[model samples]
Target chain A: MKVASIGLGLIGGSFALALQEHVLEVEIWGIDHNQAHIEAALARKIIHHKGSIDDLKNFDLIVLSIPVDAASALLPEILHQAEKECLVIDMGSTKNDVCEAVKNHVKRNQFLALHPIAGTEFSGPKAAFASLFNNAMMIVCEAEKTDENLKKKAYQILQKLKMQLHFMSPKEHDKHLAYVSHLSHVSSFMLGKTVLDLEKNEGEIFNLAGSGFESTVRLAKSNSKTWIAIFKQNKAEVLTSLKEYQQNLKEFEKLLETNQFSELENLLNSTSRIKEILAKK
Target chain B: MKVASIGLGLIGGSFALALQEHVLEVEIWGIDHNQAHIEAALARKIIHHKGSIDDLKNFDLIVLSIPVDAASALLPEILHQAEKECLVIDMGSTKNDVCEAVKNHVKRNQFLALHPIAGTEFSGPKAAFASLFNNAMMIVCEAEKTDENLKKKAYQILQKLKMQLHFMSPKEHDKHLAYVSHLSHVSSFMLGKTVLDLEKNEGEIFNLAGSGFESTVRLAKSNSKTWIAIFKQNKAEVLTSLKEYQQNLKEFEKLLETNQFSELENLLNSTSRIKEILAKK
Candidate 1:
């Protein structure tokens, strides 16, 4: 089947590479607003040929892999200009804006919102690689709004990527992603900021950083271009999540300051439940 | 060399294994207050045989690897009972209290303070491994206070484990560790508590927890016995570190609330410098 893989960054580029390695009969056409990305992706053999918005009519499927803002802004235009039978799907992190943008459009049933739960700290076409989505969760939002026949085709593509698909309403996906995914990035980035500030004089202490610190601050390296768009798209939920996280951190600070050792230990024990839950996942 | 490995938990047990693997003509005698740990460690061959605090005089080197409170409490007695030539060192996370405890002892020259920058969420004899110290930093505190010849023997042991040893005063070690190690655990545990509390109903969100979340919260699973002692022993500095961290989180929260997207993006960019520093480590 013919495919259009837009936004040749980590998520999109990886998706295209995964498709090429898994599906023998598939042809992936690349499209990106960034000329450098398109050039890099093509040189990396991430896609077969460069395509445009006008070329959307020639594909059986169109996958949006750009920043959330771009995907939300361009969805209506992509649907309006593309062929009727062309199934368009987005791999954007936030789903609400995209879902709302096309809610009343005539080709609404052709659009599906998806967030494949995978990524590295790195970005751009050069950061893409095969099996990036393998064994990861694929959260499908507003699935009921999409055409049934088109979803089956999309599901087949996801199956080839070896994703475990789960359904959620757009509202639910936005709130949940804010807490589990978005909040993690903010907390980690801020934690990195705290360390860099506090440890500037203790240059010797950097060597003391073990695997735990590395893992804890790994998301600090995520590019702001991609994240600023996500934080903007899910601003309300992110604000709420950050408020709750700050409250929790404040309480912990109070315990440490007051020398409430027992209470601090208990608070830590409550969080230990995450280990069991995460291990199950 | 005859080595008395006191407290056969993660650090000491792992030290025993490393010594067996690297140093020739070495006999490791394990000692612990816990009867079960003694049995488990002996069964796992983490120690050549089980010994007691009373056997301290029989060994050329005595390694303390118990809770900071216990290490601080037992150090004077161990030094009093041990031979004058025996080099006694405590592999405790906090240094100021332990150093203060034994500062005026006649056997002070035989005591050295170290904080090996290595560990996992898991603990006990089973957690011990031969290469746990490989390429990891060993923070040697109050080296000037210890006898020069004994410090060299200890350095020789560290070198055999392939450790990059750096010397610091107890004050420097405590304050630096508060930021570099202790504070990371606090941020991680609190992040876990926040997620566990907020995402209780959003069971589906767990599926979306990628490697980033796992890394940030991995320290939450660390046992309280060890961490509680660490937080207690280093209470003042831990409290100070927690205050700075809380301030940073609050500033980030304010930016999110005020919709200062550009400033938030800048903060994240500033934190990204950690990536280069960590890569070098």
Candidate 2:
């Protein structure tokens, strides 16, 4: 199968590598706005050739791996330019805006809105690796909207990459991701901001930074172009999640203020149930 | 030199294992408030024997590995009970309260306040492992308060464990830790609470849990006894950090509400500096 991977950053680049590793016959074409990313991905052999949306008609599969805003804008046009049998898939973090934008389009069936639940605190084609999707989830939102044959083909290719398929609606994907993915980024960013803002002598004091602080704030390192688009697209659900998170933080502070050690322990114990929930999964 | 590890949980048990691995002849006498923990550590050979504060006088080194509250409550008595040559060291997360409690004691010079900046979300003897302290930071607070000879011995032992030693005052340690260690736990716990509380069908929705969310919320699994004591002991600084964090979240919320994508991107870009800070360390 011939494939064109858009964006050429962490997710897109890694997808290209993983796809190439899993299926030897699969040919990946690189499409990225950044010339450096295109050059790096090409140098790394992450793709067979550099291509534009105009050239997408030559491929059987086109993966949209760009930022949500860019992907949302390009999806309809890409679908319009694609062969009727072409399977167009998205690997964006948020789903609502992009999915809704192309929902009523004439060639909508050619595009499958999907998110591969895998990444690291790094970016660029240089950050790409072959096993990024190994043992991770590939969330397919609005799968019913795609052609059955195309969905099956996409599933088989993802299965080859060792990803667990999770089905959800575009609405469900946006809501759950706001709580699960987007909110965590918000939490991590604020954590990094809080520490950096509080410490004026960042270089000296960062030596005092431990693994817990580092892990909790790691998502704060995410690129602005990608994440800013996600935050804007999933605005409402993200707002709700933040409010609930702030309320919890306020309550925790109150417990400390009142010297309610017992209550604080109970709260912490309740929260610790996340360990079991996470472990079981 | 003989060592008594006073808590058979993650930190204490791991400390014993790391010490035993580094120094084949070092004897670790285990002490714990939980009889089960003592038995478990003994069976695992994490300790040479199950001992107590009463047995501390017989050892050349007394390692206080208990929770902050228990360690805070016991430090004065442990120092008083310890032999003059026995150096008492603490591995508690927070230090100011414990240090202040014994500042006026006659045997204060024998006690050195220290924190190993290492741990997992898991707890107990089974979770303990050798090399846990390897390539990790060990903060020795108020080292000047301890006898110079005892401090040297402690430094040599930590060096054997392959840890980097950082010296700071008890006040500085507590304040800095409030921003670095303690605040991150609060962030993780509140994030877990926010998600758990909002999701009614948590077990079903948790299937959506990704690595990003899991990593950000991992500290929520920390044992309650250890963290409650930390929050209570360092209440003021934790509260200050929480307030600052909440303020940042509110500003971020407003940015999203007003469609101020540029400002949001700038904030995220600035916070991305955490990547550089963490990488250097």
Candidate 3:
């Protein structure tokens, strides 16, 4: 089988590597607009060859692993040109926009909207790892719109990659992702902003940053281009989460102002439920 | 030398372990109001023996690794009864209140206020590790209030543990820590709250929680009691930082509302400087 992956950066590059490692007799082809990323992916041996859309006719599958906004804009064209039996899957962060945009495409049944809920803060081809998706959840959205054989193939691919699969609608995926994924990036970015703005003395921040601060602010290093696209794609849900988050902050501020140590402690205790939630997962 | 560490939980248990590993021929004693903690510490072999305040008189060094409020209330009494040359030090998250409470004590010169900028979200004796302080910063505040020889001994001990030493005034340390440490806990706790509120469907959040959310919300699992004391001790500084963070969020929200993607992009881009700042450390 030949697998062609577009936008061969972190997610795509990792997918290409996973295919190479796990699948027998699989040849991986890569497509990326960024010349540097393509070269990096090639040098890193993440792909067997670099391919163009013109080569889409020869591949068994094409995976779109770009930003959501870019994926939404490009999916129709890619779907229009791909062969009827070819499987096209996207590993974009947001799904509803892409699904809506390609709903009417002639080859829409060939496309599967998937979000492999796995990533590191680092990006680019160099950040790809073979075990990046191990034991991670992969959410497949709008599966009803996809062809049965393609869905089976996609599930087999994810299973061989050692990912647990879950299914949901594109609308549900977007809302939940805004809370769990997109909001985290914003919170981290804002935290970095808050700390940077308050501490004019850079030396102090560097000197005093412990593992807690490092872990909490780790996602602040995420690429702005990708995050902006995610935020824009999931704007309404993101906005709602942001409002609640800001309100939580304000409530915490009021507690601090009144020296309500008990209330503050109670509020913090409520969030400790994440430990149980995370532990179960 | 005999070392007694009060409050044998996370910081104290780790410090006792560090003493066993680093300080040659030292006898370590554990003290905690929680009988279970004391029993757990002994069972885990985190300390050489269990003791009470009666054993405090026999130790060459006495370490206070309790919550800030408890430390503030206990330090003066501990100082009043400690030997003339006994080195008393604390490992609280906040420094100002504890430093001030012991400022005019008769044994002020024998007391040292230290905040080791190291910890994980997990706590208790089981969480103790021998190399917890390795390559981490130990901030010593108000060094002038400490006896020269005692301060030297404290520095020597911390150095023996392989921690880098940073000296700052208590006020400066509290202000800086509010940004780097305290604010991170609050941000993480609130991020957890926001996600937990929105992710009412358990399976969705479990499936969708990528590394981004996990990293950003990791600190929310920190001990509530310890953080409440920190928030109370550094209330003013925390409030200031919280307000600034709220303002930044509001600005970002306005940008989203106005479809000002460029401004939002710039905001995220500017905050990415934290990567460099953290990288330097």
Candidate 4:
């Protein structure tokens, strides 16, 4: 199988590496806008060749793993360039815009919208690895719109990577992700901001930070370029989730201000269900 | 060494177990208001004997590891009961209140104010482990107030457990902890509350929650009893940190709402310093 791995960053590079590990006769061609990333990916042997959008028809598969905005912008052109038998899949975080971008394209059936829910705070080719997607959830949006043969091919590859697949509409995918994923990044970023602001005044404050603070702020280290595009594309949903989060925080603060200890305990106890949910996950 | 481990919960039980592992010829006497906790500690071999606070004079050391409010409430009595050679150390999260509680006690010189910056969300004796304190930070507050001989003994035990020690005033400890520790809990709990509230209406929302959400919300599962007491004792400082956090969140929300993408990116990038801080930690 010949695969075009676009945007040779963490996600794209990791996908290429995973494909090479799982597929017996796979060849990955790297295509990245950033020259450094391409060189890094090549040096790491993540891709067999450096390729471009012009050569899309020669490949059996094309994987898009750029920031959400770029993926949405280039997806239609990618699908248009692909051969009738070729499948183009986008692994962007937000799905609705990308799905809508190719909705009316003549080769819409050649496109698959996928979001493998996996990543780290770090980014770029240097951070990529073959096992990044193992045991991770892969949300495939609007799978029915894709050609059945192409969908089957994508499923085979995903299964080989040991990823669990779930299907949803682009709208449902974005909405759920706003609550579960995007909001988490915002919360973590703000937590980091708050602590960083105070750390400037109290130089040794971080010495007291324990595992909880580290875990809570871990996502604050995510690449700003990627997250800015994601936040912009999913602005409405993110704003909604952020508002709800602020409201919840306000309620907690008010309970504490009023010295209502029992109510405060009740609030905390209710959220403790996340333990069981995460355990199940 | 004859040691009395007061309040055999996660912290107390773990301290007892660590002492048994680190100190030669040591016998741990467990004392807890909860009979189940004492039995669980004894069964897990976290403690060797069941004893009461009244017999504190017989022990060479007394370790108090309970909720901050309870620790603050009982420190004077515990110190009064300890013999001159008995070093009484309270391993509570908040320090100022506990330090104040024992300030005028006749046995004040025997008491040490310590906060071990280590724990998991899980609580109770069952979660206790001897290695919990290994390589963790142990903050010693007002060490000068404790008897020199007792402080030396406590330092020896802390070193044997592989804990790094830092000394600061009790007020400084509480103020810094409010920003780095207590505020992180509030942020995490609110994040969990927000997501859980949404999940109630959107039944499958959690299916999309990834490692990011799990990490940011991990502290939501922390024991309500322990946190309520910490927040109560450190209310002034916690409230200050929490307000700053809320302000930061509001500013980020405004930037997003106004389409100030560059400012949003800058904010995220600036806070990314936490990555280095945590790595250093």
Candidate 5:
């Protein structure tokens, strides 16, 4: 099987590496508008060859692993030109926008909207690794709109890469992801900005920052272009989650103002449930 | 030299283990209100023996590794009973209150206010480890209030344990810590609460949670009792930092609501400075 991957950055490059590592008799062709990324992907041996959108007509699979906006913009064009039996999958953080944009296309049934729930703080071709998707959840949204064979093909591919498959509506996925993933990035970025603004002395920041701060602020280093697109595409849900988070912070502030130690204790106790939720994973 | 550690839980137990690991001639005696913790510390080989506050006169050094409230409440009594030549130190989050509470004590010169910027999400005797302080920061506040010779002894001990020493005023330490450490914990706890509230299906949370969520929310599992005391002790600074964080979130929300992608991109880009700061450390 031949896989033509768009974007050829972190997610795409990593997926190409995973395919090379896990699948038998498979070749990956990389595509990206960023010439530097394509060059780096080639130099890093992230793909077997560099290809273009025109190559989509011949590949067995075409993976859209670009920014959400770029994916939404380019997907319909790829759908129009792809072969009937070819399986096109998008590995975007926000699924609803892209799914809606391509809903009425003639080749819509050939496309599968997927979100592989995995990543690290690093990005670009150099950050790609062979085991990026191992044991990670791969969400397939609006599967009813996809052809049976195409859906099966996507699932088989994910399974071969050692990913757990999940099914949910695009709307549900967007909402939940806003709370769990998108909001985390926003919170971390803002936390980084807050600390950086206060601690002008970089030496102090380096010396005084412990693991807790490092862990919480790790996502602050994520790609701005990718995150802006995510926040824009999932605006409403992200806004709602942000409001709730701010309210929680305000309540904590009020408790502190009143010196209500027990109330603060209760809040911390209530939120400690994350341990169980995360541990079960 | 002999050491008596009050509150033989995570921090105290870890310190005791470090003493055993680093200093061959030093003996550690555990003192805690909870008899079970003392037994567990002994069973875990965290300490050589068990003792009470009455034994303060016997030990060459006294380490207070309790909650901020307990440290403030017990410092005077412990100082009043300790030998003049003995060195007393605390490993609490806040330094101002502890230092002030003992400022007028007759044995105040023998007391040292230290905050070791090291910990894990886990607590209790089981969480204790000899290498907890390796490459971590040790902040010593108001060193002038400490006897010069005793301060030298404390510095020698911390230096032997391979920790970087930073000196700052208690107010500066509290202000900076509120932004770097306390604010991170609050954001993490609130994030955990927000996600848990939205994710009614525990199975979905367990399945969909990725490394991003795990790292950002790691501190949400911290001990509620210890954190509540810390929040109360550093209430003002925490409230100020929380307000700044909420403002940043609100700005991002506005950017999202208005489809100001550039603004969002710029904010995220600016916040990426955390990478440089962390990399330097």
Candidate 6:
């Protein structure tokens, strides 16, 4: 199997490496808008060769793992240029826009809208690893739109990577991700910003921050370009989630301000059920 | 050395375990208002004996690891019961109130206020581990108030656990912690609350949530009884930190609402510097 990995960053590079690791016979070609990323991916052996979208005939699978905006922008054309047997899989965070981009295309059957829910706070080819998708959740959006054979091909590869697959519509995917993923990113970024602004002493934060602070603000280190594209493409859902989150914070503030200790404890205890929810994972 | 661990939960139990692991001669006695905790600690070998604060005369060190409210409530009397060379260390999150409560006490020189910057989302004796404090930060407030000899004894135990110690005034410790530690816990709890409220389908959150969501909301699982007490004790500082955090979130909302993509990206990029700050930890 020959694969083309678009945008040689964490997601794309990791997928390329995972394929090479799990699939017995696999060849991955790296493509990135940044020359540095291409060079890094090649040096890291994440890909066998540097390739371009124009050379699509040589590839059996194309993984689009760029920012959502770029993924949407390039999806239709990538699908247009793909051969009948070539599977074009998108691994972007936002599903609806890119799925919509190629919805009416003639080669829609060859396109798979995928969102493998795996990542680290770090980015770029240097941050990639082969086991990134192992035991990770993979959301397959609009799977019915893909041809049966291509869907089977995608599933086989996902199975090789040990990904747990779930199906959801593009809209549902966006809504749920806004709450579970994107909103958490926003909250983490804001928490980091607030602390940075208020605590002028970086040394103090360095000395005082515990594992809790590290984990809570970990997502704040996510790539700005990638997240901005996501927040933009899924604006409505993201806004709704953020509004609810802000309201909760406001209510938390009021409880503290008004000396409502018991009510505050109630709120915290209820939310602590997240422990059980996550423990199941 | 004889150590009495009051309120034998995560911190207290973990400390007792660490002492047993690192110190050559140690006998630990447990004391908790909750009989079940005492039983659990004894069963888990976190304590050798079920003891009481009234038995402080039998111990060389008394560790008060309860909620801040209880620590403040009982600190003075515990100090009053301590022998001349006995050290009574309060290991609660908030330091100001507890320090204030014992400020002018007759045994002020025997009481030390400590805040170890180490913990997990889980609590209780079941979660206790000897290595919990290894390579973790320890905030030592009002160290100068403690007798030099007793402070040396406290330092020896902390050193045995491999804790990095930093000294500051009680006021300074509470203020810094409100931003770095307390605020993160509130943000995490509220993030969990917002997601739980919005994503009615627990299955969706369970399936779609990634490592990012897990880390960001990890602190939500912290013991609510413990957090409420800390928040109450550090009310003024925590409120100020929350106000700044709320303001930052509102600004973030405005940026996304007005389509200020560049500014949003900048905000994210700036906060991403938290990566560097935390990496120093």
Best by TM-score: 4
How high is the TM-score of chain B in model 4? 0.98
Residue B230 in model 3: lDDT: 88
Q: DockQ of each model against the real complex?
A: 0.74, 0.82, 0.83, 0.86, 0.83, 0.86
lDDT at residue B166 of model 6 (Cα atoms): 91
Number of clashes in model 6? 0
Write the residue-wise lDDT of candidate 2 on B201-247 in tens digits: 64467788788898899888888788888888888888988899999
Chain A only: TM-score per candidate = 0.96, 0.96, 0.97, 0.98, 0.97, 0.97
lDDT of 6 at A264: 96
Candidate 4, superposed: residue stretches over 4 Å from native: none
lDDT values for all models: 0.87, 0.87, 0.87, 0.90, 0.88, 0.90
Over the stretch A125-159, how does candidate 4's per-residue lDDT look in tens digits? Answer: 99999999999999999888989998999999899
- For model 1, the superposed segments whose C-alpha errors exceed 4 Å read A202-204
How large is the interface RMSD of each prediction?
Answer: 1.4, 1.0, 1.1, 0.9, 1.1, 1.0
Encode model 3's per-residue lDDT on A1-281: one tens digit a residue: 98888988789999899988888898888888888988999899998888996667877899999988999998998888888788999999999999999988888899999999889888999999888988888889999999999889989988899999888999988888888888888888988888888667555566688888888888989999999999999999899889999999888998889888788888999887899877766
- Which model, 2 or 6, shows the larger TM-score? 6
What C-alpha lDDT, on a 0 to 100 scale, does residue B142 get in candidate 6? 79
lDDT, candidate 5, B56-170, per-residue tens: 7877899999999999999999988888789999999999899989888888999999999999998888899999998788999998888999999998889889988889999
Model 1 C-alpha lDDT per residue in residues B133-197, reported as the tens digit of each score: 99888989888988999999999989999999887888888887887778888888877877777
- Candidate 4 TM-score, true structure as reference: 0.98
Cα displacement (angstroms), candidate 5, residue B249, comes to: 0.9
DockQ of 3: 0.83
Instruction: List where candidate 6 sits over 4 angstroms from the true fold.
Output: A201-203, B201-203
Score residue A238 of candidate 1 by CA lDDT. Answer: 89
Clashing pairs in 3: none
Clashing pairs in 6: none
Q: If ranked by lDDT, best first, what sequence of candidates would result?
A: 4, 6, 5, 2, 3, 1
